[model samples]
Target: MRLRGRKGIRETIESQHDLVVLNPAEWKGRWAERFGNEKPIHVELGMGKGKFISEMSVLHPDCNFIGVDMYDELIRRASEKARAAAGREDGSAPDNLALALFNIERIADVFDEGELRRIYLNFSDPWPKKRHARRRLTHAGFVRQYVRLLDSRGEIHFKTDSRPLFEFSLNSFADLNIRLRRISLDLHKDGPAPDNVMTEYESKFYEQQMPIYRLEAVIGQEALAEHEASLALAERQP
Candidate 1:
């Protein structure tokens, strides 16, 4: 399905200027100041339509949330939904939520070292073609970048309906010696917990009785160093 082109998306975003930051690069390394608090920051990459992250800001008031997506239209849609959800009865979005428009590959440019406490990847694009393996968000290179942006004990929580993508991500994390925990192959069948906030896609997939794979991975210093060393060694090889 093609996305509906949003007219005046720029104006729409500007209207919710506090809720959406159009130029994420300018705020790099100083996101905490922008949030006006020292609260732990969490981000959701590919946060389609903003369901998960918006609800997250409401649920965890102490933690700031940033939802990143590449498309202007998607960000516009997400901005509206999130503002509506976070708004007071009179109409005001939460101070803890913000949305960024940028490709995930430039994530490092938007966040500095150890600036994030958690990262969420929900129903991300599978990028199934073998030739596009490197483009998958869970690819080694991306994982390495995530590790750099996360503080000690920070974790990445991932969920997907694609078996191949889930399996590939599992292997990718293992190869980096990252610690994996709380894995579930059929999330809905296992039953939703109070803490399980479903995204728009997650809800639809659950209604369709499709299995959802989920896991939490921790990238400790040792694991990150090991992965970097391996990459270095591979680079020096003929």
Candidate 2:
């Protein structure tokens, strides 16, 4: 669903600097300063078209939200959506929301250790081929990186329509012995949860009678210790 050849997409994203972060690395460890508050920061990796993040920002004014995606067109679209949600015609975003164009693999470069309070992975690419498993957002390597950026009470909330991806993610987290909770194999079986925010893809999937899977990975001290031990063992092996 990558958009290409969109005229002026880059210009549009740059024009809304208030909503789009062009140099996120500079904001590392200072996200609160960027938001002008000390509220917890929540990030949605691979945020597509920005429906959920924008809505969440409006709903939770006490928290700051950052939507990260690599595509210029998608960032531009999200900026527009953020502005529309805030009812601003002058291209301003909601005070708590910001969109950024960056590669998810290099996320650690933009946020300092324990900087993020929550991370969201909604309908992420499954990367179905077995050989491409490491590219999955929930891969153990990526999970380790996420663990480094999360505070002691931080959490990673993941949702997907692909069952295989869900299973793979479950195994990945288990390997690290990370604590998980609120796991749902069929998220909308009894209708959407009261606090759930649906992304555009999720909304379409729901209408098509697709089941969504979700889980919350908590970063507890014991789990962090195990993760560090595993990394140490790997280094020793090599």
Candidate 3:
């Protein structure tokens, strides 16, 4: 759900410098230093409105969280939510969370190799058209970027209410021979796992009794080799 252009969206986002990262690329390889800690980092790509990441930051103070969205309006809203989650009325962000405006295609420029422990893709755009498949978050190209950013023990946690997208993502991972675990075709079949955090879209779908599909793709040695090979093949293409 893309929001309409709010009147001072850009100004609003710029004002929250403490919570929003204005230039993410400059902090590449130094995210832990940005947070002033050495805790593991988890990032949520395309974090719409930020209900999930905000809650996750509050729930797990031991890990640092970065919420990335391309829209200034969405980032602004997410910043307010983060502040509220931290119970700070003085506009300070949570110690463990940072929001950034980023285009996912250039994600590699913002994080160094093995910088992330986990990546979240919650209810991402399905991009139903065949020609647009490459734009999907779970596409092989994006997965390759994720593999580079994630450490050996890293994981990609993806949740979606769109069955077609779920199927596409599963097949994409399979083509790379990536290891997957905790796959649930109907994630809320037993009524919301205690450990599950719901995004705004997810909560709406859950209320309407929609089935959510989820999977965790683990980064293993085989996947690493495959990603490296793909990168080499791309380098040789032209």
- Residues 99-140 of candidate 1 have per-residue lDDT tens digits of 999999999999999999899999999999999999999999
Task: Show model 2 residue runs off by greater than 4 Å.
Answer: 89-91, 220-238
Candidate 2 Cα deviation (angstroms), residue 168: 0.4
**Best by lDDT, which number?**
3
Score residue 153 of candidate 1 by CA lDDT: 49
TM-score of each: 0.90, 0.90, 0.90
Cα lDDT of candidate 3 equals 0.91
Cα lDDT over the full model 1:
0.88
Report lDDT (CA) for all predictions: 0.88, 0.90, 0.91
Please list the residue runs of candidate 3 whose C-alpha ends up more than 4 Å from where it truly belongs after superposition.
89-91, 220-238
Q: Tens digit of lDDT per residue, candidate 3, span 116-164?
A: 9999999999999999999999999999999999987688999999999
Worst lDDT 10-window in candidate 1: 218-227
Local error of candidate 3 at 160, Å?
0.3
